[model samples]
Target: MPSLRIACFHLNQLGDLVFSLPALLALGRGFPKAQIISVARPPHRELLLLSGLVHNVVERPRGQLISKLKMVSALRSMKLDLAVLFSTSLGTAILAWMAHPREKAGFGKRGLAYRAEKIGPPSVANNLRLVEALGCRVEKRDYVGLVKLDESVRCRVRDLLMHAGIGESTPYAVISPAASGRRAIKEWTSEGFAAVAERLADDLDLVPVLVGTEADEVVAGLSEKIVDLRGKTSIIELAALLEGAHVFVGIDSGVMHLAAAVGTPVAALFGPTDPAITGPMGEGHKIVQSDVPCLACMKTSCREPLCMQRITPDAVIESVAMCVSEEKNV
Candidate 1:
């Protein structure tokens, strides 16, 4: 087989990007001589770089039309042998089509979903299908790739936590209380998170550290029991903190996926999204979700949102206990 040049565009949401790791790793191994160009959004660009799965990571900043066009020009210059799209956006398909690769494959066709009986499968399996189209079958399909942590960053985060009074002997749990702004309905109540954090502190003797971006500050502040590290650490720094966490408790968001990527125990709280589709993609993770009638609706503008409301703090705490207990057993 001749050497191939592969261009894969996977600048999706954080959870979706995490789901693509196994396929990307397999592709790199399947064609060792292939010059794989990975395209992803910020933070994820750092992740792909840390994973060392691609020859180069094409940084695609948000709201940058020129950047996208320039990437297309660069990809066209490569004369790509295969173009794999992990997302189903029309723009992504056009980008793949515009690149004029010898073969193009993706999850579900955006325009063709209506005519087809079924749309995309689970996010993880869907991404693997793109690699499968190129005649490669992955032996281990659940890998999110190995994430390399900078020792300097890890030491720095430890110093920061120590300054915050978290000693080296203290067992800490990471609590990510927010998701995307548009998907607020997917989040559990602030009171529920607070209750869980308090219980974790009081009963388990574990410090709950709230970690997220500025968007997560409100909920992180709601719980006085947690050590709010919101908007402080960079993405890689946050990964280092999660790497040391004994347990990670959060919604169906990217941080949960990140914790799973770093081999941490995750207590994934699900509401609007299906756990089977986007739960923590690793072992020894506990999922806490309600069986509400309107659960898994994937609605952005839900008025009632009982699905999120019904997931009680007790359930979350139990899930946390289960996750940490499994961690202890391991």
Candidate 2:
């Protein structure tokens, strides 16, 4: 009631965190006077701080009992009125309960122990249900673009583009071929990407730029003409680069989400993952996927990744070309 203090737990990867931005924004808007504290993984600190969705970013210690206790104790010390568990993990649910906030909300049965209502919705809209439960005004946001790029960052990105021989007016397409180690099945083949790169150059007359960490080196040889910016830019820099591009072509990776968040037309290639849920949301985004019945199996490891192999380069090229053409018309 008086000067509300809230703690929201989201100890997830970059893409999942991005998906929660809409709900976070709605929550912040509902309680302008409230201190929105975000407890997330250490890697998410930059985004959580830059997003302006939360006032504070607290790191959730990885697999440490004492550290977990300290985290929950710290929240309890703040006299939090509400604790929203954006994460579905049992650990996070227990932490929220331990914090003993006046109101607790999350999805699943474990969360129901702390709060009577179980938050329901897709990933993006899940936390909004928690905010609405507390009688907060939640607006329907079209896109949950949380990051705001600074003018200085934009200038730096421009300099990088110039260095890469990409002109100010040059229309380019950004491609990311990297995925986490465990999700290698989600990545399309290197040969497929090379074919797409050549198509972009010959058919679209647009330069192809690769974005990712040095881990992307595996796909670096996909095409020689591609400008490899892997391991060269920070996360924010990658976002800036993707923001300026006309089209983004990538797997369902965090970089893809970054590009989509910046409103770039994305031709996302979905293989082992489900496009309906994890696919890029909002307008101007197309999912090029194989018609494999087991396509969305969500398997981390596979002896034969037929789902990814089924997604041909021609299909991805067509999707990217269509997206690029649509952008030009706009």
Candidate 3:
């Protein structure tokens, strides 16, 4: 076959982009000389830029027909050999078809009309891990890890730690107590996270770093002793920070996936969702969930979130302890 210039489309949120990194890396490895482009959103663009996997990041604009037409025109200009649509949306499939790549690939489900050399249903473990399912020859390798951080980002993180009055050498854990949507029933309460942080500090002598966006500052504010970095770090900076942490504990959010991508040990909380579908991937990660009947509802909103409420701080602390101990043994 000729050298393939591929375009991979994953126009979802941050976590989606993180999980898709391994597959993108595999593609890059398989076709080292080919130009690879990604269609992503704002923060995701920053992520892919930092990831160093794609040759180009095409910003997906927000508008109606005119904007999409412009994007299609751009795709046509690339003269791509292959287009991989990661979503099940008909619109995305249609876009791949209209782009007129020699080969279009995506899930073969729900009557999505597209000509593809490879197609399969979604995998529950990791979306990127699905590359093996595509019938492509994949080495039995540990799923490709996230891209390495540059020294500049690492130095910035060290400065951030110093500004926070945290020593660069001090081992710490990050606690993210906020979740974005109703699918985020996997999030523990602020009080619950505070309790766990307090215990971990007292017992393990590790500082607790609180992380989130500005809207999540209230959650970080609940912890008196935690080093709060909410609303401060960018997506790339957050990944660098996670790289230096000893362990990370968070709800089912983008940060948790970031920690996993950076190879940090993670204790992720799962509620009202299946860990199989969206939990943290790779080794050195543990997931804790409640046995509530209404769990895995996958609903955007819920009136009663007992599944989340029932996951006590003590339980989370225990999971963290286990991950830390395992890491030390290794």
Model 2 / residue 119 / CA error / Å: 9.4
Kindly report the root-mean-square deviation of model 1 from the true structure over all alpha carbons. Answer: 3.1
> What range of 10 consecutive residues in model 1 has the weakest lDDT sum?
111-120
Each prediction's TM-score versus the true structure: 0.90, 0.87, 0.85
What is candidate 2's local distance difference test score? 0.79
Quality of model 1 by C-alpha lDDT:
0.79
Off by over 4 Å in 2: 61-76, 94-100, 110-122, 141-144
lDDT of 3 by residue, 56-157 (tens): 888776657888888889999889888777766677778777888877666655333342333232332344444544444444333326646889988998
Off by over 4 Å in 3: 29-33, 50-52, 63-70, 94-98, 108-135, 140-144, 294-299
lDDT of each: 0.79, 0.79, 0.76
Name the regions of candidate 1 deviating beyond 4 angstroms.
108-122
* Candidate structures ordered by TM-score, highest first: 1, 2, 3
- How high is the lDDT of residue 228 in model 1? 86
lDDT of 2 by residue, 1-330 (tens): 568888888846677677778778888888889999998887677667777889998788888899988988888888988887777777777788898888777666643424424333245655566567666677764343666677777888899989989989998889888787768888888778878888888899888898777777766776777988777776777778888998999999878888888889999988877777677876888899888788888777899988888898889988998898888798
